[model samples]
Target chain A: MTIRSVAIIGLGLLGGSIGLAIREKLSEVTTTGFDADADVRGRATANGLVGAVCDTAAQAVASADLVILCVPVGAMGDAARGLAGCLKEGAIVSDVGSSKRSVVSALEEALPDAIVIPAHPVAGTERSGPDAGFATLFEGRWCILTPPKNADTDAVSALTLFWQELGATVELMDPDHHDLVLAVTSHIPHLIAYTIVGTASDLEDVTRGEVIKYSAGGFRDFTRIAASDPVMWRDVFLNNRDAVLEMLGRFTEDLTAMQRAIRDGDGDRLLEIFSRTRAIRQAILEQGQDVAKPDFGRGSKEV
Target chain B: MTIRSVAIIGLGLLGGSIGLAIREKLSEVTTTGFDADADVRGRATANGLVGAVCDTAAQAVASADLVILCVPVGAMGDAARGLAGCLKEGAIVSDVGSSKRSVVSALEEALPDAIVIPAHPVAGTERSGPDAGFATLFEGRWCILTPPKNADTDAVSALTLFWQELGATVELMDPDHHDLVLAVTSHIPHLIAYTIVGTASDLEDVTRGEVIKYSAGGFRDFTRIAASDPVMWRDVFLNNRDAVLEMLGRFTEDLTAMQRAIRDGDGDRLLEIFSRTRAIRQAILEQGQDVAKPDFGRGSKEV
Candidate 1:
């Protein structure tokens, strides 16, 4: 069945962007959105992020064929439980959480009767909140859907089509695999960034002011990733602790190996690894996942 | 003396950009440049990276009042030694190496009779070589000079003026302090980026294709940094081993703490660190070291 009416449970960056994308691209789809914060709800409504801003999650999902919970991963179970008795039978339920295994388990347990498909759109800016979203945020981005093994094929296809219509390339994977994959590509990178930025700030010899002034040397890039929504990332790390710790373990081992190479003055080994990593960047660019411009296109633009 | 002739050795990104910037900004200064690679020398000549591309390092340094060595940190001694007898008496000599302590010592030992002053322009893109340069590459960026205590004040001022003319802000730092600051800002960041990208590539559960496709989730930024010139980075890690290792130790401690928080479900600690790092990003932006636009302004530009 086609998704004609949609309800978004959280009007933050991901949720607000979904609402805006739907309104801008699928004009026929009726959008209903709600947020825990009153100010966020007001901003989302005034910005035309949704056609209707409901006061309650139950009111938002009552008439909708699709309900997407866009809250933090830690809050997924509670948000799902709040939708009890409101979701229409056969209506598809989904979420935009960074981690899939825990979220899928929480959602499936909370809504046993609904068709739950956990998905994550691998796209975002460092900004957060209702006003930090845009219509084209999903354009050229990937959305991975982790549906249960016994999920209805038609429901999965419909959810895939819904994301496709909003400008996302869709993929299907098991929930465990999704968590593992995202842990490597997203979670570990963020953890390293946060750790390094904090490390730089806490240095006594290198003043914080000096670090900020000379950040363009390379530290600024890490700052951007570390500046991502704190609560959401904290939830991600907590929810996906197993996968995150596993990947971080591998990262620490590799980092220690590199550290030993540097300490031993192994230029050949350092060059080998550095050269190998350069090809991956080229692959990312060739795959159309990133821009080829130098400095991530930061130097060409005006402030 | 008001410098009129400038010689550039190495003719790569930093050297070529210096030539281009001199030609664009200081029209009266005669530029001579030389690179070890014949193809790079020919390209620098054709691209007008310098007024004259010399056939040998000796020729490049023979007639210039100011000579700057733009080679990898490990190669600075060899490059400086190559100009031993060719440099005119009383001519100023400097270098653009990421690590200051080793480079200053190398140049001072190799060209003991010349005015050896080491400087590092804290500006670059991922790409390297002669073609990866522009006249405005150093605009508004910091160029740090670490001159010896016994160095002539007029020579230091002249070097500072030369970089300022090319649109760089000049700062005077001791060699050890410069190396320590850059160890936090540039060297360690590049090392972590390379390590994480390599770690992601070596994953057994996730396919390389999958990692590349979902890279926008945060991995893409690290790839850009890891894509930087491998040889230069190798030399940096070798020359700045002490400081980089020191900072990496602190980073490991911080990351271990973060890992513990994640494992123990300490949301408060994660949130506190994340929130603190966000303010550093803001401070970097306020200092004009980074753009305020989200995602390094990658979303607004076309590939």
Candidate 2:
């Protein structure tokens, strides 16, 4: 069940990274990539993001044993539909969308004859587009596969092994559960970051210059997250609405309680919550989910 | 008005960094430090965080021309009061608290005769304690000085020069304005981060292990901020109540709008807000407040 050829649809951060990762870690496997944007296609070709930069999505998936749709979740259906008659007879169709439930449904609806195993490699940076990606982007990261009920086991195993070879730890989870987990762990966080960064930008009392200057006080961190791909995030919120809203409700309620504590001068209550959150960070570092160095070691390298 | 001798009242992250920075940049300036906790005092001595780690706050400030209180905002009053009888007649008293108005009042009230020029080095890491300090922590970071009205000009210039010598760019700001500005830039961001991390930890649908495992998706950034010193944050909320609440109200309104957009499937509105926030990140990078590299350059260094 080894993947002989991989096709990446949409040469953005995720797509370009997948192409480059395949070239670097799975050099023996043939890689081809395509983007709707001709400029991106030109850049991808120039950067050698893939072994071949195809003119169309259909051309990319024609010879691929594994076809991964790497566009925004909202565009997954179109991306999948474009490959309807072009994909190899046994091609396993997959995607690297943030949310899994909608993506799985979209791919299944579009590619009725092709095998679809939706996966989300939980890795990214704030930057996007063809030049923003690197070969090592997926290394040491998690890639959750959400195979449909009673799907082909061999196809799933091949995809898992492919991701593993690209330096990712693979996990299998239900599509619904993956959406809910990502809602809390990823979606809501990005939403909150976007909201706060906007809030700071629109302030009447504080100038944008001031916010930018004193950003080291803590605001800079949110700016990085808030700077992530807008179209990708917009589609994420639309596709994972229920889970995102549910997580947002919980976050808003907790934030309300914290606001009340601040207004009421409940130092003890504030201390309790603040104290407990540190343990979660410790666990994250212990599991190697994040680096333990201060300010993500930004001080040493940049400053 | 060259500051010949300086005393640091709390030998934690901010205090210890100040001491080390002084040693590295202004080697001839005598530096003495004291922490309420004897263990921290011992660590300060062992680490050579200052020229002398005094046993008492009074002993630390006896002959110093300047005194900087580096304790939590809630403890600034007591720390200043401890130095009342021992400070030199014309010694300038300052602090490194997040919020400035309350700190200015607390220091002025506790040391009526002292030249109080409260300053906040808008720089730090989540890591705290005596051993967490480093000489370059303030390098190229902003330090806002909120000196009292009619304060000695020479003393203010000397204090500003002192921060500059430590590799920080200093700016003068009104205490109240500083509080309001910091509420958006630091306090509210921290409160939201703490709230989200807490919410994620308490979710029944999402396991803590899952949250940690998938943190790199975006949640881990909030966790780094949430891991900041709890007592310090607790005091920040308590002291900067009005500004934080005001900013929180605006943030809540914006978040509510985003929630409604998601609920109504308004992709255009979501994209607009998400798109605009990227400009702020660009401004932050252009100002040298944050690194231009992706993921704060974490990928190249640690992973």
Candidate 3:
């Protein structure tokens, strides 16, 4: 079947961004969008992000070949239940949530026989909402699809094709693997940033002021990460509690060991770890993942 | 007295950048630079960061009216002792070192008669060496000067004016306060970023690769911070051990409490801590320290 119509279940950053990218890429398809907040729906429509903005999640997914749930992971079950019945029979229902296993498990259980595919487009910033969304957010990024073994082939194919059209390199993986990987990569790092920035906030005003002013040295980078949407991160930390805590445990143990080494003037240990980390950065550079620019080239916003 | 020439010891990121910024910002002065690495002297001279690359640290400061030491904090005392006899008797001696009190304390014994003013430009990046220097690194930033009570008026005035011309807002604080402030702000945070990135690097290669790829979310920020010059940071941690460990203790306690709050699903605490953080970001914004643009923005040099 020709994919001429699609639905986006959340008009915030991820969903709105998908709408922008899809509209830019898929010339013949129409994207209908919906969000729980009416103002977001209006903003999405005004920005020409979608052809139509629907009042209800069910109405938005109707007559559409694919539906994407782009809400917080905590709201996955409720959001999936709202659209499970009205979604087109062959339409692929997927999500752009951070934690995959729980979202897929909850959404899949909410509606029987629904072709639920958990797809996470590994891209975003600390910012959120429709205004924060951009068309190129997913370009050259990885879109991971954790499709169940028994899921519909046609649905998975459609979802995969859709993401590819949006300029993403799609990879398929098991949901359990996705959660563990993301827990170490994205979830735990974000939790630590938020917690650190939160810790800095409680410092005396004079000391706190200097923290932000001299942030370019190192701390400012954490602030940018910490500035990410608290609600979204709160949900990720809560939903992926086990993996995060596990990573945090490993992280703290390593940190304590490193601190002890530093206290003991174990320069060799510090240099070894520091040098090894450089290779990971080099690998990221080789994979065309991270930039080796100057301070991420933040100093040259005008340049 | 007219300032005719300046000397920059330790031609690394901070030192080289200061040379570049000074040469770019001030038209009249001649700058003679030196580094432990002879190749760095060649690079700085070829890059026109210095009018002449001196044969040695003592040679660089021999005829100079102003000497700025930009070496790692651990090397400050040695550099000061090396140049003490060579420094022009009435010349203004300052530094861009991370810690003020320690640098001043060490230099006090080394340069007993010279007007040694400890300073920190409150700027830098992960990159290092002469190649990493930039002309505007100090533009719109703070250059903190901690002078001894009996510092000569002309010496302090000339150096303060020099940094002001480089586009920094000069601030004065007690040297000990500078150390404590930087302890909480820069040292602790760098330690955390380095620790977390180190932890992630130890993950299975497959997972580690994905972490770098999706790092844009939050982890990338830490990597950028982690990518900092390990030797310089190792020295900072070693020299500032007490203050850093104190901050570290506070951070650990805060983190454990935050972990409990998340495990308990206490959104109020999560939201409360996160909500308070936005204010610090706001304060930085008002101070015009952080750019309001997307983190590093698009078209950045990440790789």
Candidate 4:
């Protein structure tokens, strides 16, 4: 594979950003993105995120060495099926879906004759659209690849280098393991956020207004997470239902215990749990995942 | 009564910040603060957050024209009764407790002859202690005041002026209304945060480790919320039980609906509700309650 051309399907935040990242990393690579929405393709080209806006998925991947699928998780199988025939004989196919097991399995069955590699670039924001994409979006973020056991080593190496060149540190894991890790890290957290923010949205009109007014205290954080792309998240929860619900059950049980502690005025138990959680925040800071200061160094010189 | 001297009891984050705000805004006021922890009193005086440090609540309240109780909600009653006799004649007392109804009721019943008003500064951070105090902490924030029905008008005016001078936009409301408002905004949010973090804290060791590693996506937000002053939040949920439970019931019901929608693959319904919440984020931005950027404008400007 000469690897001179790349096709990115879905010119939303992830795909558009990948287009920019790849272009920045490999100047010789001619990137073409095809979005189902013409406006997205138009915007991606206008923003210089893609060198060319392919007229169709087949047109984009017609002569590319790598074809990327960055759509909603639920749409992966259909997209894989659509591109199965158009993809070059030995070209590598990958996705940036949050989940892995089901997506990989579906892509495998949908494109039995094509080599599909499932990779998740663990970076993003609540914002979507081509305008929200940026080249350095993947800096210092992890990108996990879950390739089938029988997949070609050369194809995997090529895919790894492609993501690594975009400023992501690549890691390989079993598809099932990737799903489990994400369920714990990303999916469950988002579910809880959506649930809490939804809870506030249902309050009596007066209280709902107050919740919005004073959200910066804590609830606002949940609202930001809850505000993530709903179609994408809904598909994630539905596809990863068993895992999300399982983790949610654990969460609710723990919540119920805390509720009881509050009711019983068990300050010791509350403080103990708070102390443990604070240590986790410290660990996140140590790992460079979060800032040590409350303002996260952004408001270092605030008004 | 000439307002020459003021007493700030409990000298922690809220008390120290109040001392700083008062001293910075009121040049004529000579402020003294006392804390159960000797080190807090020493630090407050040494750091110049207060004009003086006293060994006892009685010592601090004696001869002061006004007294402000900035302790945990659970201790408001004790602080109220303890200073009743020691407070100078005609001295006005107020608090910065989060739960207005409980604190007001407690203070009214415990110190019938003393002037008491309950207030909440709708601002703070996860960090506590005297060193965390800042004069700007209350700036651009709302200080919700809950004065009793038969409260002295002059006393209310003086306190309102005090907060306004500290750069807060003070609003007056009934104590019950204040409680209801906070139940939706502060108390309910903290309860959810504590519950979610407790959930993550109890996960299997391997999964728990990964949760910390990848927390930046969303869980990190909840962790910061959950890491709030534990004692303060425990008292909030317990004292405002009726309102919090009511709001919690509404929230649980809403969450059930969201879960059902996701389980059934109802993308439109999820999108509608999630989209609605995005407007709330926008409102927070417009109102200057929260910034519009992710990671709260942390991370690199380009990334």
Candidate 3 total steric clashes: 5
Q: Model 2 Cα displacement at A262 (Å)?
A: 1.0
Q: Name the top TM-score candidate.
A: 2
lDDT of 2 by residue, A1-303 (tens): 778999999999999888888888888999999999999999999999999998988888888999888899999999888888998888899999999888888889988888889999999998899998888887788999999888899999999999999888999999999999999989999999999999999987899999999999889999999999999999999999999999899888999999999899999999999999999999988877777677665554323
lDDT of 4 by residue, A1-303 (tens): 457788899999999889888888889999887888888877887898888898889988887888889899989988888886788777778899988888988888988888778899888888888898878788777788999998888889888888888887788988777776777778888876777776666666556667777765666667777778888887787788777777777876777777677667677887777666777777776777666564443212232
DockQ, prediction 4: 0.54
The iRMS of model 4 comes to 2.2
Query: Of models 1 and 3, which has the larger TM-score?
Result: 1
Q: Candidates' interface RMSDs, in order?
A: 1.6, 1.5, 2.5, 2.2
Error of 1 at A110 (Å): 1.2
Model 2 bad stretches (over 4 Å): A300-303, B299-303
Candidate 2: residue A29 lDDT (0-100): 93
Lowest lDDT sum, 10 consecutive residues, model 4 chain B, at B294-303
Where is model 1 more than 4 Å wrong at Cα? A300-303, B299-303
- DockQ of every candidate structure: 0.72, 0.77, 0.55, 0.54
lDDT of 4 by residue, B87-200 (tens): 888898888898887888888888889888778888887778888777777777788888888888888888888888888788888877777777777777778777777777
Model 4, runs deviating above 4 Å: A1-4, A25-28, A205-207, A295-303, B1-5, B23-28
Ranking 3 against 4 by DockQ, winner: 3
Q: Quote the true-contact fraction of every model.
A: 0.77, 0.83, 0.51, 0.54
- Please write out the lDDT profile of model 1 over residues B80-174, one tens digit for every residue: 99999899888999988999988888898998889988899999988899998888888888999998999899999999999999998999999
